[model samples]
Target: MTKPSIVFLHGSGTNADIFRLQTRKLAALLQPHFTLLYPDAPYPSGPGPGVLPFFEGCDPFATWMDDSSAAAEDAYWSLEDDDSGAARLLESVERLVREEGGGGELVGVVGFSMGAKVGMEVVRRLEGREDAGGGGVKVVVCVCGTVPYRGGGDVAREEGGRRMLGRGVVRVQSVHLMGETDPWRAEGEKLVGYFGEEGRKVMWFKGGHHMPAEDAVNKQVARIMLAACGKV
Candidate 1:
């Protein structure tokens, strides 16, 4: 029996090695039920508007999309045509399936902040090509997830996002965990809207812009993901 693999995407300024606090805990439980594949972002974190882009003191922190825009500092983002974020990320994902001999069944992806954007992008990009195989990422768990933006207005209606919404690759179902006090809470809500009325859920936690790191929170997070993947 092939063990279904679950991909874990780290946030901005963070790498696959640093599974965030919550992911570190959830990974413990996930070990028994699924294969966990963690992939680092392609580029090291760079100067963002004003938010010193390094995770703690970690060196070479990576990021998916470089937000080199003048719009709202932290709100505007653009992917260089040369280093497309989705393409780079999928490279890591596909590499894992082929080299590691895993992902015989891809159950889901749980991403945090910037990592969430990477995961979502993968889902959007693979929208119409599941026939090629290993592109079936239908379950998504967003922890402090940031909406993927490009110059302007959430681009779910165009390109990859359009295919995702149209259920081209898979009928993506999502579970979003947002912090009540997080400044990006509203943005997360807006992302939920993109998923439409059904097969989507948002849960509020008491904290700032971070995922729950406590054991209890980790359990609930795992439960939600397992349920979404129909593994529970």
Candidate 2:
């Protein structure tokens, strides 16, 4: 049988190559069971956080959207519903799935940081348009993720105009890896909350805002991914 495909999306200001290096350990464990696909974002960007020194030579970075500091701050405060970039990303993933999946199933998505947000947004969009035969993503693995930019439309608010929690739950089995001391831990938690609790597994690592480097953690994460892929 043709192996299923899993799309791996890189964070903002990073390219597919850097994401491959970051998730090498986890990919090593999953490669036997799945075909992994990494695609670069459309917009050029400066180096993202944690890309200094070691990954300095790996320049020519990219981002899914206009991730300027000012724009990001404004979006966060205004709850802007701009999803054009995420839509373009979905187009890229669909093309990659058609070209690179080799007639195999498009199974899951593993994304990091901004990639995580973009990936989930794409998945959520697919969920709405999927047919009864079920071609939507089966699982999602988010590392240091953030909430989507209102792809499902403006989120419902409470009487006081406070955004309602669990209003736009993603109906997919998900694995979220959060860094214990990461600056964006809260955002990661919010991302987890967006997924259905029954199928969501949130794991925390000791490090901050990076992929899990420990052998044990990698193995554990791999096992969960295997289960998601129905390999174990």
Q: lDDT for each of the candidates?
A: 0.66, 0.78
Where does model 1 exceed 4 Å of error? 20-22, 46-56, 70-84, 101-103, 131-134, 150-170
TM-score, one value per model: 0.76, 0.85
Clash tally, candidates in order: 0, 0
lDDT (10s digit) by residue, model 2, range 1-232: 7888999999888899998989999999999998899999887988998898779889899987754344442333232244455455677788898899876777899989988877777787677667454565889999999665423223322211234233356788999999999998887987787688888898888999999888898898888878877899
lDDT of 1 by residue, 1-232 (tens): 6777888887776666666444677788777777888777777775322234334555566776665343522332223232554566676787785666353666688888777766776776565356665366657888877765532344532443443345422248888889888887776775665554567778888887776756777787788777766777
- Where's the lowest-lDDT run of ten residues in candidate 1? 72-81
Point to the candidate with the largest TM-score: 2
